[model samples]
Target: MADHLPPVAREPAAESGTADEPGVPRPATGDSGLRRTGARGASGPRQAYAAIDLGTNNCRLLIARPAGDSFVVIDAFSRVVRLGEGLAQSGRLSDAAMDRALAALQICADKLRRRNVHLARSVATEACRRASNGAEFIERVRRETGIALNVISAQEEARLAVLGCHILLEQGEGPAVIFDIGGGSTELVLIESGPAVPRILDWQSVPWGVVSLSETCGPEGADATQRAARYQRMRSLVDEAFAPFAERIAPARADPPTAESLRLLGTSGTVTTLASLHLDLPSYDRSAVDGVIVPATAMRAIASRLSGLSLAERREVPCIGRERADLVVAGCAILESILDIWPADRLGVADRGIREGILRSLMATGLRRDGAGALRTGQDAV
Candidate 1:
């Protein structure tokens, strides 16, 4: 498809920032007294922790606290900037695209500052990894926003995604397929069953996604047939690349009568939007859509509906709002193509991914501050 997409125990710290007021106190890790109020009386729950994801298409921020095996979401921000726009053709981040992305990052920086995030990690994915001027852009972002963006390699990207969204596989009947469709590239990781942790047998990253495919196969202001052909072409390319992975997983058998069960888990915008449409929602609701199982038949029907709509028409759909209208269909194509190769009864949707993974890793390493309120300096969280 065309488009892509932490708690601690500590004396909960407080923040003065309000750019994007989070709903709950920043989740704390370890054992600490949770001070809901700020230093000043009347201050509400405010712990300071932040994670930033600068992907091919958007800049997103999440501030939350650790809650048992998972974390509860507190404050969040997401805006599409298409940081990797035209990156495939030029092999560089366009100035206009960089500007668009940086603007969004500015807001993220502001939120981080306001929240006084003690532990923050900001990462850039495929587009930046492939860009000739990505290092320069990173330096510029540091100079302007004081937030450096780490351009992660494909391997790390796959691993982190698995860490964040693996919960979807926990309840599955068998091994699951997880993929992320980004603006400049897409990552596919295969997971096999295990009680301790699902094993990641192999992973691949393709330097193609919505923006690249749209530019490569779609016409400039393409007509219906052109768009359809573009989608088909994109699907074909993905299918071709996916064959080897399919072969590796196929031997697991139609019904493995082992101690483990399996299912399909998906993150990225593609699965989320499909889940949203499965509910025929009037607006996006992560709580309702995420972690919900969408039948394979329903998934196909929704993709067909998206294929029939124009960019403008797609925007009209409650689930495919203006922000994601263009990219969702491309994402749908990739998901559908992947499903065609590997069929499963139901696909589990995960709203959480890299950011959650990052936070979880940090907390596990004791890099996170305790709710009682002291930062534990130690080994690297990564």
Candidate 2:
């Protein structure tokens, strides 16, 4: 873990921003950094907690102060770096990809420092897990950015994703499933949870995310026929990967899920992006999408429509620009597969996940003490 950050480096928005606006990923501001109105929990001064998540598709950071049962976010940053761009074939983190990720990490480090973060945890996901040079890259990050990153296991990844989003699960009596369709992998967590919070009953991580699936199928330049065929093929692959999990949950599936008995929650670019489309927003709005529930049929329609579009046509979609156009269909494939297995009426979207999980862990355990600092930022008089 120490080797992952050699001490170094590290976006956006048109949104008013907060938990509701995790969507609009801004480009790294570079020298401009980010100007934010500092915030903190009313707990006098336990200082602030920070979390950084470096995924194959994006790098994000969140700083907050524990507020009663949860934390109030003071600042946040996210950028789509596509860190695992070519790893599917190369089995390595490409030079260009590493450069992009390193730059993002640097920005996160600065935010952490400037915020006077009392406790911070950073983690890297599937891309790093699969890269042959992943360890080396993490070490370099630590040295260059002065931030340490933990490359977590699939199980831990599933757990954290659940920890981050389960609070948003719909109130119900039966079991629920929360999944994250990421860049290089997808995690599905099945839990027999109710109002208090869903507990992880079982979970699965498939090595197919929007980035990896698109890479595997190469749908960018294909004609409509080819793109549709490729999208189905991607779905087929995800279905196969998900088979075991589906089988394992057969007992739970005995009665099937209804809107009231079972719920589906999703945390990832795929779900959030799809939610934005479902609402037909002029631009991505986290508040509009986050914790919002959409009909499963509506989500599938968006996915199918997107699959039939040309790469150029996709770039014209509101929330999806050139940055996400190519990867959206693959995400659709993963999401559709999830909907199929679970057969739920509605799908819930959560913009918060790993970062929130990390913050909860730190604050809950006193792993990082509180009352040591007063302000959310370094400014003395906040």
Best of the candidates, lDDT = 2
**Alpha carbon lDDT at 53, candidate 1:** 80
Specify the highest-TM-score model's number. Answer: 2
Cα RMSD, each candidate: 7.8, 9.6
Query: What TM-score would candidate 1 get against the native?
Result: 0.80
Report the Cα lDDT for residue 358, model 2: 76
Candidate 1 residue 304 Cα shift, in angstroms, is 2.0
**Candidate 1: count of backbone clashes, pairs at least 3 residues apart or interchain:** 32
User: Model 1: how far is 75 from its true place, Å?
Assistant: 2.0
lDDT of 1 by residue, 1-33 (tens): 111111121112322222221111122333221
The count of residue-pair clashes in candidate 2 stands at 33
Candidate 1, position 202, lDDT? 72
The TM-score of candidate 2 is: 0.85
